[model samples]
Target: MSAESLTPTETLVLLTLLAEARPVSNTELKTLGPELRAASRRKLTRLGLVATDTSVRPFTHELTDDGWARCRTLLGADTPPRVAPPVRAVYTLLRALGRHLDRADLQLYEVFAPATEEVAPVDDTSPTVEGRIRAAYRELAREPGAWVGLARLRSALADLPVDEVDRELVRMNRLPDVHLNPEMNQKALGDHDRAAAVVVGDTPNHLLSIEVA
Candidate 1:
């Protein structure tokens, strides 16, 4: 369904998720605005606009890629019918901001990055698979956004389980700052490289890029 078809609460939920750029629980959502009730959650999930992780208590929700695209559409859409005056005003500003972003060739994620928290260094402890992947990428990449072959990357994390590493890679790829790509120069791939590839969806990604913060 289009952004115009979303209910007011649904609209708020999507926008909040977009702004937060992190999974939010119902309790946390209450502080921002309306809490996401079960019925609304089911509708959003059914529409493939939101992803709810039930593994945790109070369940946390996050926007899917489709949800992000839906919010983008709203920037150009007319305000939904019967919205409060304040919300209408917000939309007016959003449309204007959207125009500015379009002219600047900027992505919404670039403007609404998730907040980073400072933590003590983890030099004494075993690093997470995701952390190891980032560390390996940093070592191999001459600069941020430089493509590092998965074969070489995997070699650095060889002690870690291949399946576990692949799962983390797929998850990391979903983030705006991380990218996984198949080598366009297919003729250059050796057997070792092919074996090291991680399959995301139907594509085998041989290269990794992580935007260093």
Candidate 2:
């Protein structure tokens, strides 16, 4: 199927797999972020975009040819291989896929685009959870209509109890400008440094996001 035929979540999973030139374990996939859940992956597999090797305990996966073709078309790349290796790969082939594509830029175009409205300059490097939460809301909620990812919000609130942050987002939903989504989006995650923060060093299937735009 074409890019238009896939859901936003499905598209994201495919792109993540496409970023990896080698077979990535589902465990490593989880390290990418929370949106790559088993259900989303299963749906992608059913659609013939991703292949899984369940023979191992933690199954490994890669993009199928059709999946690569679709992702390349969406990415507007004419390269021979449709998928690129993770940024950590030493091989040059994977870097070629990244030649024209940036994870953030692709995320905005094919997945979720952040608001263009300029935000009031707010210092988000607060030490406390409350301060961090306040800063995160300010950072993520500058526009009247836009969406931000949970992974981003957490990065903004670094070192806080993730669950507490979740509660805070839900609490803010009562306000007119704020909304909380339990739905997970992994697009902004996994630039190598984010691996440790993934579920506090464990794979987290449940992801939550807040919108203040």
Candidate 3:
């Protein structure tokens, strides 16, 4: 569906559902406090951007593929280019962290530190790199608590140069890994520090230890 074809309400609903991949029930939609939920749903349905299934409890509602395409278009230049390493690495890290943390915490972290980069396209007219990146995140999100480390993440990002790895790490640190809370920032930095400590012992992984802005 084209963005131009969407109404204001329909656009809002589409954006919300795109950001949240899970199936939302009609009841949940009502609770969103938006008086336009019903109206928005009707518009989206007409545009073939959403589908409702009465077979499921709460009446499962999910965005169609066309819906996501329109969302990507709306996302526009704000979207980052696909970077494979971070997607793999973040998933692995989240899985490992989940073994020791709560599932809610992991989900919260994913929401805050969303993977923005899309994979580079091999040819014109092919799916944009971002689509592939989104697919990778979906794959990882499906399998919570899958263990991955820096080494494994690096392997997935074999196309990136060594300098790019450093750059990516710096960029990642600047992002809110577990939300924008100051406490979360401290914890994420602490986690990185601990990981570096293990690697460098008394020497310390100075590069990793550097504070992120």
Candidate 4:
């Protein structure tokens, strides 16, 4: 992968291989934890920065010769970057609403597509969709002190198709008291708007819980 495209863990894997200077067993790469190291190794392999030493029973991996050069380049970069914090879709909507924009809600809604973000899994034995949502909400959201993870909640109440949950969550966002994805990208509502906006995660803000007013 391009240096810029590497995820943190992937970068670490490259760096680790550079440091070890020899093939390391997958078990040994567990210095960064097995799950993450394995995942990073997979990505690194795809990018041609790492290769598996299949000569052994269990596979081991190490950086390629080019991988060493990539590491050197990353280490040599000395320029400081001028970058702004990423902007999130929900926060963008929040700012528009704060400004009382005529069609801000509609405009922002078009992007997040929370209505179709996820579809609940099917299970005929569970309660009705609405009933499940209500029950899950009550149990998990006596108050949104801690955000209930969307995926976790989805699994908790997976009887309905995920799209049904997404639709309800989108509708729920309309409530003044409820804040879907309230832990939004931080930014000033007025002024300080930037020339460009970038979304960081695939769906970092998707998981949500309600908050008390």
Candidate 5:
């Protein structure tokens, strides 16, 4: 669905759900005090931005694949200006970064530092190594191939200490091979990737030219 057609409430609702990956009960949503949770779900469903199965009690709401994609697009469209406060800019950058990494990679970062009150799975109790790695690649698939190099990847870790940067790179490099895909080429790279690369301000020629095996 197009962002222009989505009401403010629907947009907020979808963003809330995206922040919380698991299924959210109606009661849980009500606590958000948005007053439009139910209405937003109904509206989003009509727009095919969300799926609801009232077959069971309490109802279950989850964003469909299309819903998730639409949400990402909307969020990208509405991103605040770069000159915004540091905290807001950081959050914006993280969301943009999430678009390029795999789900596992996103989850790993969230597991270590969730932006919201939600908690990620504890270490040792999370998904299999392959599962996490595939998630990371899924995130990367959302971006352009040219931005998935060591330098660009390192910039995503700028908030970390010098020592932590190497650690993160090591971990990212070792993600399960199954997650890598040759089909995610340059076209998939979005404006956010370019902006991030620019912000980092040091593109390594060798890293940008490397091909995925």
Candidate 6:
């Protein structure tokens, strides 16, 4: 569906997810602005604009890659029909920002990027290699338990020894909260993705996820 076809509530939901740039629960969505009830959630999922992980209690929602693209289109779009004045004002400003971004050649991800919460600080002898791995995962994943590509994870921990990182990943997978999964779409695997995979039980797992406390 085109951006123009989206209802005001749907548009708001997309905007909220874009602003968050992380997995948000339906409950939290209410507090943020839009209440993403069953109908809207299903519609977005069907349209490939959102991904909902229902495996966990209080299912979490995040924007898919297509969702991000759709949101970027909204930057240049006119405000949806029947929106209130405040929302129209938001779109007015968004259009202006979109023009500036276009002139500046900045992608939306560069502007609405997730903040790095944990990383290897310069102080030596503090965080262990395992600790560093966890930090890297947090920086990359949309939420806890979200599947993060191993290739991206390894890039974040580039300073560490490759063997050491792989060994720790194997050990961490045995934990209850940690999981390693193979990319089901094997055709999408590039050389780097294949090379970065950690083999577990003879399976080359290309994704890593750790449940947050």
Per-prediction CA RMSD (Å): 5.4, 15.4, 18.5, 17.0, 14.2, 11.4
What would the TM-scores of all predictions be? Answer: 0.66, 0.34, 0.34, 0.33, 0.41, 0.56
In model 4, the Cα lDDT at residue 157 comes to: 66
Residues 78-194, candidate 6: write the lDDT tens digits: 877788998999899889989988998665654664344232233334467778888888889898999999999999999999999987786566455677788989999999999
Instruction: Tell me, by TM-score, which candidate is best.
Output: 1
10 residues in a row with least lDDT, candidate 3: 197-206
CA error at residue 1 for candidate 2, angstroms: 4.2
Q: Write the per-residue lDDT of candidate 2 for residues 133-186, one digit (tens) a residue.
A: 655655775553345556666777667776787545533433434443323456
Better by lDDT, candidate 4 or 2: 2
**Candidate 6 structure, TM-score to reference:** 0.56
The better-scoring model by TM-score among 3 and 4 is 3
Candidate 5 C-alpha lDDT tens digits along 1-213: 444476545656666666654456677666752344566667778877777878876776766656666654553454444433643664476577566555443322223211343222334434444233233433554443433443444454445454444333333332222121221355755554434332110111113221232
**Model 1 agreement with the true structure over 1-213: per-residue lDDT tens digits:** 443377878888888998887788988888977789888999899888889999999899988767877878777778877899978987898799899879986656556646652322434245787778888888899999999999999899889999999878866765767878888899999999999998753367799988761
Question: What is the Å distance of residue 152 in model 1 from its true position?
Answer: 7.4
Candidate 2 regions exceeding 4 Å error are 1-4, 76-213
Per-residue error (Å), model 3, residue 178: 20
The Cα error of candidate 2 at residue 50, in Å, is 0.6
Arranged by lDDT, best first: 1, 6, 2, 4, 5, 3
**Model-by-model lDDT, in order?**
0.80, 0.52, 0.43, 0.50, 0.46, 0.79
- Per-residue lDDT value at 84 in model 4: 26
5 or 6, which is superior by lDDT?
6
Candidate 3 residue-wise lDDT, 6-102, digit = tens = 5444555665565555466767665652333566667777777787786987676766656655554443223223535543453354345445435
Model 1 alpha-carbon miss at residue 185, Å: 14
Clashes of each: 0, 0, 8, 8, 15, 0
**Deviation of model 3 at 171, angstroms:** 28
